[model samples]
Target: MKRIARVILLLLLVAGLWLALKPTLGNRRLTFLPQHWSEYLDYMDFWLNLGAFAILGLTVWFALGALEKVLQRLCLMIGSITLMNLFLEAMQSSIPGRAMDRADIWAGLLGCILGIATGLAFQLFAVRKKSRTTSPQVLFLDQTGRLGGAELMLLDIAAARAADSEVALFQDGEFRTALENAHVKTHVFKLGEEASAVDKQAGVASALASIPAILDLVLQIARAARAFDVVYANTAKSLIIGGPAARLAGRRLIFHLHDIIADGHFSSLNQKALIFCANYCARKVIANSEATKAAFIASGGRADLCVVVPNGFQIPEERTSTAKTSALRSSLGIQPAAWTVLMAGRLSHWKGQHVLLEALKSVPTAHAILLGDALFTDEDRLYAQRLHTQAEEPELKGRIHFAGFQSDTMPYFDMADAVVHASVFPEPFGRVIVEGMLAGKPVIASRAGGAAEIIQHEQTGLLVDPGNADELAAALLRLQTDTAFSSTLARQARQAAQDTYALDAVQEKIESVIRHIAGSNKSQLLSPAIPLPKPPPCAA
Candidate 1:
């Protein structure tokens, strides 16, 4: 038809102009072809280039249509063109007989920029055409009546504080109070009476009895997800409760994995449940370490679906406690002359406080202070009771002091000679070791899990075999008796902590990962969302 012929004619004319102008538009050899022809063509080239871009502009405008969502498209186009310019410049510098043409590069960049601006303008116009919509929301969920590691993480995150974070606790108790104190938005669900509760309301018994309460919690998550673009679950119980709700609300689900497993923390039955839900129910699992990521894969969870983002810290400008040094020492009833050894964590068996007590039998001149106690789930209260009994032993009596639980540990950290983490099990990420190092204190941690990853042997701090009393005693004696060696370790420890675990460096890595994920998401949206092709199977 006539329309087809006219389209062909337009295409031919455009091709002719490009072919005629190619040599002049490229390289610094502007006059190589023919002087007169070059002058004439160069002038024409400017307008032709403009026209080409105008056509490109029009094509982009048409492609976006009435939707008018232009910035993303503009960013895509401009970013692609900029990368190409870099490549061309590198080629010109490397290739023989080809000099870098600054003007041509600028022209190309200008054309790309103008094209992108025009696309954005069209998109802005489209936005004017669309109706108003609400901003997206975020939902956070945690189980247990106590505020411990996960609760502290959420509180610190909120206090920083990010926008659009809402926290809900599975059972209400002390954690609710702490959440309130932090000025964080929180909801507490009463699973049962105090007596029948798990750790007074933290258990499967309470969770099962509160079927109606669970349904309500599900409804809240569903509502929140509908309002938000994504629903992020901060606990395993939340994934059990919030994952289905998010799916029902047509929202994405993200799981934050704080716990690391090797073979036997959870029963096989529970592990199977975690693996199934992590693989099929959630869009992504954010693990705190590479070890955690590998564990997920080994446990039959999707390897590709896991992301590793280390937990970040905000180094306080000042230590948490302001009491005079003498007062802090006096509060623990320590004589001015005693060498104080401080341990700051819940006084539980797994924390290896009992082992520390036994280790103290060998390091006589040192007075040890156990700072934290009976925090988190009361499920460990019996273990704490045993620790209390061990501490009260006639011979061990006056040497050790149990300072129940203090919100601020910095004052104690300031007063102590050294900080120690003697965990029997591998911690996913031990903040205490990092915290101690940041305080410029010499640290001794068990050689286990993320602790091993963070501390360099004989450099940052000393690492002893976990649950070994004699090894811990030896490390204690070395720091206590050898002042120069302790000073050397302390100096190196602070430097490493600042260099590696400093807030900004960790944040930069997190930002890089997030930007990469965001870019990947955009790419997926641009391409047809055909199911990702199955990867080839490994040979037996």
Candidate 2:
């Protein structure tokens, strides 16, 4: 119905424009037109102009893809149509038998205002209909509100489902701001005291110490879940806290598993606890990659409830211009002759910034940029400081640059000759690998968990053994020395990323999983799951 309405509006717009411009194309007498300004209000041409411009304004409003706010869309339509009317009126004076009339412009302006008002009414009606029928109420829960890979992924999910979803954050930070900017309603739960960072290394005792705070958070989530049809746990901590809360509210729980629940990534205690919560509290579990799913099952998670659904990425709308890229590189003090490499992620020990620095020693001509900051705990901060100290060593001295915590990593990606991922431990999903591929850069990633799943060895990209600086250095040097091979790898990687990891594809899969859970009865939801067909290849 909306498409048909838009088509009709477009046809009307074309006819109106043609009618308004017809007289200006030829030498036509304007004797029928008003002789005075007061007479313009009574003239047929005045009404025609008003109707034409009104249609034009409505067309513009309907053609808009997505606007964050209704008022912003209305303003855009009114301003655009007003300027177009003024230009048309100005052109009348230059035409053979046409006279520029201020009254005509006023009529058009009035029409534009009316059109915007009409558009607002239509929007309100559509929103109401959507709320009543189409839009499902979803509650998204995340433990941390900070911007990390998982947090970024959660932002994308919330943005895609913003029409019917509300987000609940355990702690408030930049991620909450991102969700709000995307027009998703966000609520932040405050613990009475600062909560400890949730990490496997923190041990079960450390987590137990925050029991009071966790209980308070669980209560808040349960209350919020009651208003929503489905509760989505977007991270590890969220699964632990939101799982039981969802059960309490009698809401379907879908846990998005973005971690590898194995000894390499999580301690045995943390892994067992996560599996227990998922099996007992969650109706379904969506893993970010096959590796993540396998790890979860190996840790004794219920395989019947789990399915693999990889992270989606978007190709950059426009490639960075050469001039802008040069300017950025110059600002960063990168030498023009130097081959630049970028490693982007939070500066955690397992993420491998330190490993990248060690590898850089073998590639003397290549300059390295570390584009992230330590997040969460003081331990991460100290680890970052140690990396800084490591970069100061004689081998890496002038070649390594720590470009701390970039909110936007695209500029660095644009400036780099290649991108590297060198995690010492297994990753649940490596978002940076796909991002680099989307940017059309050759990626060299560790050959351990999800990164291995993303890069097809020498096919899509080069994969080195995790924690092996020698192999990483070799891959880097190969790219630097072999331009043709590098370009071929980049092209293939980009194609793979676009084909499998596009945002819409992943969102569709996730929505299907949620809908399945939401539609099922408690008995059906917990029954033995049939084996899911393998997902199409993706960067995860």
Candidate 3:
């Protein structure tokens, strides 16, 4: 179907271009040239040229298909069409009865702009039609609008499902902007205003205070849930609020477990409450890693209701030139010969930005770049300040650089010799570990939680004890000194990442789970569990 459409568009473009330029081509000679813009406007030939260019522009726009960026699409359409029309008009000046005029160029530009607008409108209408006819309607509920690891993962999932899904954010923040940029339909529940302000440290008291607000938000979600086939809860807070709402609306609920809901990260009471919600309300539980699923089950979540689905990433196209990498290093004042190690995540203590800093002291020749900032909580802010103070210490000065939060970290990944994951606590899923692997960088990750699941020790990548600076430092030195060993690991890791964590494969698995629950009868929703697939050999 797509090939046919492209062929038709190509034919139209060819015909339009021929008709628009015919007057200035072949045996035509220069005569009766229009000296003024008014003279060009009076000629009926001007409108024919303008209409031909408009058709040409519209055909070009349709041929481009659905581009991820609207601005880039518009620029390509308008700029290319306008330049082509202007060049053709200039050519017309040398031909008889084919006079060049500024008015003709302006008319063509206006027509191209109108054509682009028309193409965009048609594209939107087609999207709506496809959503209604082919795809399942999904309502995604997320707790915070902050762009944390889970939120970033959610954005990827939402982007994959955007053709038929609507995302509801509990509170407004940067994640909302990201969703909008991805062209995903998003809604912010204003009732979550008070709930969003509550501090993470407030514990049980915070939960108690947010109940009324949560209930109000639940009512809003329940009403919205009626229109969707699946209610996907992307966070613990969302599962708590949206699970009941999904139940109220008689819709299938899928809980996306992104964290280790254990006593370390959550209080005992909170852990129990989370388990209760998952076991009782949610029809299916999608754990980001096997480790997360194990933790959830250990905390009394129903094993039958859970399935492990690791996060996936798209391997970015490799840079053909080293110019951009060199520019990035120079801008950061990093020595060209220095061994650069990168650690990317929010600058929270548990994320272990300080731990990475401490390890850098042992590897004096290596420079470290921390690629994220404190995005949520007062504790995270203080933690970031402490990391800065620690980095300023005599031993660490000039060796460690804080690059802060970057929306695009791929360039930094390319600049690094090795990527490190130094989380003090067990991470639910270390996205950076796989990302570095995909970039073909030797990843030295913590030998705990999901990081362990990603790296196959010395075979694929190196793993060290969590929070142990000495072990991390030793691993870094080993990679720097042992050139052949590091290259082998990086090569294997890259291949493993491509085989297991490609976005298309993972999204299909997730979509299947959603469709299964959505299609199941109400009585069978919780009774028959989707059997957990065996973990990948590298993960095992």
Predicted structure with the largest lDDT when compared to the true one: 3
Q: For all the candidates, what are their Cα RMSDs to the real structure?
A: 16.7, 20.3, 20.5
For residues 1-540, could you state the per-residue lDDT of candidate 3 as single tens digits? 447657877787676566446553233222244445434534565686577666766666777744234666687779987887788778867756566788778878888887777876787676556545776789998878778888888899899879889999888888899999999999998755557765434467777888898888888999999778789999988888898898778677999999997755776656767787788788799999999999988877778889999997876776424788888888888999999999999888888888888888888899999999998777889999998899899998998888988887889998899999998889999999998999889999989899999999999999899899999889999999999999999999999999999988999999999878866633243333344343221110
Checking candidate 3 for backbone clashes, the offending pairs are 29-95, 29-96, 30-95, 30-96, 31-96
Off by over 4 Å in 2: 1-132, 192-194, 521-540
Cα displacement (Å) at residue 36, model 3: 88
Candidate scoring better on lDDT of 1 and 3: 3
- The TM-score-based order of candidates, best leading, equals 2, 3, 1
Give the least accurate 10-residue stretch of model 1, judged by summed lDDT. 127-136
Ranking by lDDT: 3, 2, 1
Task: For candidate 1, give the lDDT.
Answer: 0.67
lDDT of each: 0.67, 0.80, 0.81
Between prediction 1 and prediction 2, which has the larger lDDT? 2
TM-score for each of the candidates = 0.67, 0.72, 0.72
lDDT of 1 by residue, 196-260 (tens): 23222233555456566656767766776655445667776677667777766655577777766
Show where candidate 1 strays beyond 4 Å: 1-136, 173-183, 189-216, 320-323, 376-379, 504-540
Q: Report the lDDT of model 1 for residue 394.
A: 67
Model 2 scores a C-alpha lDDT of: 0.80
> How many clashes in each candidate?
6, 1, 5
